[model samples]
Target: MITLTLQTIGGLMIAYAALRVHHRVYTEKSIDKKVVNEMRAEQIVGIAGALLLILGYLAAF
Candidate 1:
């Protein structure tokens, strides 16, 4: 379970970084709402994953 959690966190972090670069800051006004929503969702997932990882690591002491 811990290994799975760590792997999920790593994947989420990579995906989040990609979304942040490609969708978060746009110079065009014609961006799709779906893209915006996905970006936000990805960010949340990434943050949650990171927090879970930290908490799990702390718990393993």
Candidate 2:
């Protein structure tokens, strides 16, 4: 039961993060001042999402 809950939370977090990234990339005319570059943002978000997924998978065991 705990594993299922964790997995669901992790999945939701990943989906929400992805949606936020998509919205930012599409709606914003330019990258934020803090961000070094567009590619960097993509890489960071991608890695974070992948890590979340891996953690969720591991939690199932």
Candidate 3:
């Protein structure tokens, strides 16, 4: 039970962090090389977070 709870929390935190990164990019007014790179990185991180969340749920069940 503790492991399940911890995994869920960890997934949520990672997902949230990815969302924050995405939001930061959205709020920026201009696009540049650095921003484009950050966007690509954020997408990777977001996908990773989603995968983690899915795996955590599967493991918990």
Better of 2 and 3 by TM-score: 3
- Name the best candidate (by lDDT): 3
Error of 2 at 12 (Å): 0.5
lDDT, candidate 1, equals 0.66
**What is the C-alpha lDDT profile of model 2 across 1-61, one tens digit per residue?**
6777777677867766776776666557476645536545675677677677767767777
**How many clashes show up in model 1?**
0
lDDT of each candidate versus the true structure: 0.66, 0.67, 0.76
lDDT (Cα, 0-100) at 47 in candidate 1: 70
Q: Write the per-residue lDDT of candidate 1 for residues 6-61, one digit (tens) a residue.
A: 77568767766765675545434367878767666776776777677667666766
TM-score, structure 2 vs. true? 0.45
Tens-digit lDDT string for candidate 3 (3-54):
7778677878878787777777766747887877778678777878787777
Ordering by TM-score: 1, 3, 2
Candidate 3 lands at a TM-score of 0.53
The better-scoring model by lDDT among 1 and 3 is 3
Q: Give the CA lDDT, 0 to 100, for residue 12 in model 3.
A: 80
Worst lDDT window (10 residues) for model 3?
21-30
- Winner on lDDT between 1 and 2 is 2
